[model samples]
Target: MSPLQKIGAFGAALAVSFGAAYGVGALVGPFDSGSKSEAKQSAHQGAGHQEADAESETEGAASPVVPAGLQVTEGGYSLDLATTALVADRAGEVRFTVRGKDGAPVTSYRVEHEKELHLIVASRDLTEYRHLHPTRAADGTWSAPVTLEEAGSYRVFADFTPAGAAKNLTLGSDLTVTGAYAARQAPEPVREVTVDGYTVRLDGELVAGKGSELGFTVSRAGRPVALEPYLGANGHLVALRTGDLAYLHVHPHDDKAGATKVAFTADVPSTGSYRLFLDFKADGKVRTAAFTAGTDQHAHG
Candidate 1:
């Protein structure tokens, strides 16, 4: 199964578990309602179930689901390229077509984040990455030419919301790039810092050869505050390797407010210095946090 499939499966399991728990709680509640103790227990149980269901639904609903029957076909919504396999190539072209869920031809799509659909391609090792926006063709195909100077296993993500849909979605696929192999190394430990009167804490170290999860918590006056949505997602994070500004586009785990926090899983190709930019809405205004991260050549520090 693909990584996307794995994520979908996990989400489905969580939803099912939440629903099952609610059903069990409701079934047991009526058995002993006459006793005051039983009534208190039932009330607490019901509230717990409701909260769980709400959270499950919110996460499931926000995720983008790729409908069945969509595939790469001849003259269809397919990616056409000289080589789907790449490695340290200075330049290449990715040509693809877009169709409606019903297989009907689609002419255009609304731009999200200043583009029709933002394409984020990155190596699995977190070394090489690129952010590009493709142009729509007359026939409904979107094409974007890219260039890479680093070698690694790359994944391409299409981030966009279907027209009329209330939420944004991310679709992912993997591509292989060939060249000299270099194992990713670990970076320094996470540290707490302050930015623009806001206290923020980073919770993960950077690694060069593998994906790393970086988490951030935002607080003001020693109390957590809700973070409003910026763009279509709850928060926006961008990472750039200091030398060349290699781009890494990361997404938040959830969108709800109250206690601002966002997590991003990213890969870096080589041991180097990287700059992270985090933007979120707080105090009725957009706030950005900047940090310099370093990845070491050894174990995760």
Candidate 2:
């Protein structure tokens, strides 16, 4: 089945909103190993998926802006993956370049979150995730060292902004790992999870199509622990949809330099299960806490 077919009508609407949020023309297929040209053409072909009447609706929390990491190319820029496959359980370098509409490597980029680009890798099953900062070379090619513990299909996202662009863009592609593959189920929803002797509890709810503020407190031994800054904020969050792994744009709110609790705001496009990954620094070391959350459809203001 095609990607749009799998997403169904409701998902297609959300996908349309995602493309529109960035002022793009169409929504492309999910992560695949297809060529960039093929994917771009497929996306334009699907542009008619959106109904003419839906255009009048306000593009706010009601529409739910589902941004980036779904298409390899968007808004005149494309993610060119030089390394598409990697070996399982082995450390290797992944290389790629950002090409503009003029078909030349884009070397100049605006720095955001203390880095020019942020790379995210997650398994198709949403079970494995990683956040890496890649170094850009003089030729505009970005390279990063990564190791995949398991063999499976993974989605690679390049989140960055070209010089003079209005906003950041996330381009996604597929990476294959050769070996025996076994899929794992997403964990059940939980309000609290423990990681590395720290207990992280999630407060607030995720309501679909509404801007939700999520608060997370880090504690150990029944006492709140102060958290240092990570990526220009007290904490960082990356939430992915359960089935298709749609990457949600999470904005971390700024707080005191070293506060015990950090907050974020995110708008999910639809009602479904999502996996939330929280990255925070404490005791001078960075740690990630993962949790599963679902939207409460009935909770609408």
Candidate 3:
């Protein structure tokens, strides 16, 4: 993720008004791995989850505002990944712990969008994306199946809320997958992308510093395929800047779905290139369709 932004109109009050409070949580030492002392790693497993402010209304949360998925720690919560390196093509476990202000593993989380926590993994170029829900143990460690399968640097994001917090926290860290890395560029903005015989089309442009309307339509063999609610929504959209992997959280306007379409809005902080991953469930399985988009400034005539 890119560096934190400078304060602006949606800076202080807007951030705080969103329901995030700086608690009495103390500043702790850097969390290296999942092996910290029990005093530091096992106490505050968590309180609960809340997504009432996950995204802006037109965008995802309540009102349009700055983007998320950039910082490793915000509001005293940190996403602690056990390791930063992985082997390509090896299906392995990506383990992590959510550390609260007390420097202890958070154990409780209120459900949001039908999940306690949502984990997203994607390569820097936006070529590979995976949406996962990790299983958290009593000790506060969350683990899930992950296989980079390709040599590239990837970003791992933990999106969730802790108990009374009003908004969702999307914290991210980097992972180096070793093999033979071949960097690639994001594709040109397109109306459609295909995967596993499913074709998904993009119906919007990401506008810099503004909330932009976005929509998606899924089809196969040129026929609209009905989409089912996944994680309490017809679709979940993840947007990432091509180079730095700066994250943007997006949510559908509603949970209802048509034969093959789900609509959402996205708030982008700056202009550049982006790769979008849309996740939808149908036919008893969840599938992802990826697309590429550029900000209006870059795509402007």
Evaluate all candidate structures by whole-model CA lDDT and list the values in order. 0.47, 0.64, 0.61
Could you give the candidate ranking by lDDT, starting with the highest? Answer: 2, 3, 1
The TM-score, computed over Cα atoms with residue i paired to residue i, of candidate 2 is 0.77
Ranking of candidates on TM-score, top first: 2, 3, 1
Across residues 223-260, which tens digit of lDDT does each residue of candidate 1 receive?
A: 98677755545566655444333444445555565646
Worst 10 residues of 1 by lDDT: 18-27
For candidate 2, write residues 1-301 as lDDT tens digits: 0111111111222221111011111111112111111111111111111211232136552433344577888778899999999999898888999999998999987665566777888888777777778888999999988888779999998877677774456788999987788877776666677777888887875577655567789999999999886555677667677677776545354548769998765455567777777777787677778777776657554
Each prediction's TM-score versus the true structure: 0.43, 0.77, 0.75
Query: Which scores better on TM-score, 1 or 2?
Result: 2
Off by over 4 Å in 1: 1-83, 190-235, 238-301
Clashes of each: 9, 0, 15
Which lDDT value does model 1 have at 49?
Answer: 11
lDDT of 3 by residue, 1-301 (tens): 1222211111221110100111111111111111212221111111111112223255553643434666688779998999789899897889999999999999987665556777888887666677777788999999987777678888898877687765556788988889988867655545666666777776654456554456688888998989886665688666676676766555565655554788764344456666667677766567777666655564321
Q: Which scores better on lDDT, 1 or 3?
A: 3
